[model samples]
Target chain A: MTQANPATLHIISKSPTHQQLYRDIANALLDDDAILFIEGGVYACCGTEATALLAATNNIYALSIDAQSRGLANTTPAAITLISDQQFVELCCQYHKTLSWF
Target chain B: MIFSILIYASSNSSQTEQSALRFTRAVLQQGHSIHRVFFYGESVNACSNLIVTPRDETNITEQWLTLASAAKLDMVVCISAAVRRGILDGAEAKRHNKSSANLSEGFQLSGLGQLADAIIMSDRTITFGN
Candidate 1:
């Protein structure tokens, strides 16, 4: 039997306000792929933009340090898990490849 | 699994470079091996020795150099990107007749072939900076 494609880890560093970036990632994301929010991308957790992402996959995560630095720790939606730098590394290892979006 | 890293953001303008550094440290700490780190676009600025950070701020280039030395990492800066950005090594500076070479130690200036090699040789290629 042919093997299935491995899941990818999508790392987004731009804010959701970048509509083009959000649309691009949304279109590119696979069902089994994971989404990781870092830097300004953590802002997505505070708004409604991630609702569509949550509908797609359960493996959504945001970098806790980035969120906390942005004062988003308290406001983050429950669907997305806050991860550490170590966990970010682990996620990269788990995925087939990491695609970084700005 | 062996991994490669691609850095494409501006080291001087964004915090993404520092994030990449922390992630790299975590990867090393977890006993994972890195195949190579290819710096491209504005990220090649990190390979310049002339960048001076204020005493209170972290010198990210120095941090990368220290980590690279400790880990014996293969850090390659894109030649085309480096040249246009004025991040030249001794040879490039001499060839171009520039005033001085500013390429930082522990980093080598190479072509995009190294990036292609990293992609083909490594199990996964993770990109940091956008």
Candidate 2:
């Protein structure tokens, strides 16, 4: 049987204004890795820049309350899954490790 | 699974600290366990007892204390970060000849080695910053 690769959950809390940060995360991501956007990072779920970032990983998530508070809840693309606080904890458990990008 | 959290955001400046606290609460609620919560960078300021939050705002430090007390969490503030930011414990205050110690109860001051240990001992090490 082929063993599945361990996945990482990347938690990002900075806005896309930090252009290099996105590139750094992209370079570091593996095929099985996922991204979770929280705080100011939820802003990435909107606008044109969201497309490129969304394409980077098959699994992209954003904190629902955070996106709601920032008025991006409805505007967030359908490609990104909006999760709750409880789900966030579950995601951490589902992954091998979590790397925060701020 | 065992988890360790590294907090680097300033409690006063960013929402990330509160976010970390909420995440911890959820972790406990889900029947998961936490090995430690390591406060580094500007987050060490959250250990200061003298920080008076305005009546309108939620006191993040007090919130952490309550949770830590209930959860029996090992909350460690980075010694170098705390001392540099004026968040001194009794021993540190005496050693440095400061007038008073303001480190909050339920939080201990330690070195980055504790962080290294947490990373090794826990199943996952998560960072909350900025």
Candidate 3:
């Protein structure tokens, strides 16, 4: 509801050290879009290169369930906002389109 | 809502195929329409018939075929990835001079354009796997 065209990018993997997944995600995201990080993907926001690429991304969200379980609730970068499971569904609804990267 | 699925992991290794199967079932149960299922990377291996499965284990290929047939779903495997992994359809097998094809039933081989088309036509693109 906040933008004319909202799309949610969901990341769910660690991408190992190769980080091809990170490069792929950086190339895939569009402007004014929000990213939902869950599972091992919460690790993505902590990297230095990831922070640089995330500058172009409008909103970055991490699932609180995964964040809490991974003990990353308080450790994530300031730009990443943790949201509830219900909010994850709400994000999918609000965006009308979601691209999951796993 | 209309949904499109992307599978990137192999049936032999990753949990993507099983997860995709469960998600598709849930989507259908929820009364949503699936525009297409696009198989990329190692996931294209699901279209091969040469894989051996133990009687006790869940056959991921069969699960996808069953869903595709029952729902009349449009399942597409990326041609670029398929060729690299030796997942050839009858035509591709003939073109490549292979003795036979290994593509399982209920799946089609197409280009990345089909994936782009799926994304453009569907409401959401749900990916499973790394």
Candidate 4:
């Protein structure tokens, strides 16, 4: 009955509260989904074990601008697709809703 | 699309509330129906009528009240979150032996169960948190 369209969650915080939110939501993700990493959330795409686990689903994307700002453009895990701000906005329009964690 | 927004940060110090409000207006302008706006965590304080802002600053509580009133939107604040943050309705204040309550108009003190129900009934449940 939960009628969400294909979701595209954007996470921009690295605080404990944000981290717990990520954990809870990650566990609840369905096969039909995508995650867009931005701001501090770029850290989550740093070739960590969690990133590896999430990459297994093939539904994650990283914001290129944020990665470049944080000097992590080249170091990001290869599994993540680097997307532009326009693509981010397009994704927002394409998804039924956006859950912001920041 | 019918959507429900969950606000989980404080109104004063965090941009979460402001961003959620902006998104609500934009979504409605985009021809979407907002099923509800659920305030939780520190954001429950957003329902407190006692929120006083500087003359130069925008009164966020008043803005929320006005928007809900104009749109006849459902504004629900989590009771647990409200109680923890010292925000109570008239009835709850009496039951809890408080002096008075200052809950803003158009905002009702509710429960997380409503959030769960909204998740089930709404087309989308978008959360704004910090």
Query: Which residue pairs of candidate 4 clash?
Result: A102-B130
DockQ of each: 0.80, 0.90, 0.29, 0.27
The residue-by-residue lDDT of candidate 1 on B29-104, one tens digit each, is 8888888999999999988898988889888889998999999999999999999999999999999999999999
DockQ score, prediction 2: 0.90
- Model 3 over residues A19-80: C-alpha lDDT tens digits? 78767777777777778776567776565756644776868888776678777788887888
Cα TM-score per model: 0.94, 0.95, 0.67, 0.67
Native-structure RMSD, model 3: 5.1
Cα lDDT tens digits for candidate 2, B1-130: 7889999896554798889999999989988898999999989887888888889989999999999999999999999999999999999999999999999999999999999999999888889988
Give the whole-model CA lDDT for all candidates, comma-separated. Answer: 0.88, 0.89, 0.76, 0.73
Question: On residues B12-96, what C-alpha lDDT tens digit does candidate 4 reach at each position?
Answer: 5565676567767766766678888999888887788887788998888888878888888899989988887899898999999
Ranking by lDDT: 2, 1, 3, 4
In candidate 3, what are the lDDT values of residues B1-130, reduced to their tens digit? 6778888874545555765676677777667788999999988887889988888987888888888899999999999899899999999999999999999978999999999998889777787775
The i-RMS of candidate 1 is 1.2
Interface RMSDs of all predictions? 1.2, 0.7, 3.5, 4.1
Question: DockQ order of candidates, best first?
Answer: 2, 1, 3, 4
Question: CAPRI verdict on model 4?
Answer: acceptable
lDDT of 4 by residue, A1-102 (tens): 233466555554453335566676667566666777765677776745355338436767777876787788998777788887556544666676666656
Residue-wise lDDT of candidate 2 within A1-102, one digit each (tens)?
112338889999988888899888888888678999999999999776656667778999999999999999899888899999999988888887788998
Q: Candidate 1: lDDT of B25? A: 88
The parts of candidate 2 lying over 4 Å away from their true place are: A1-5
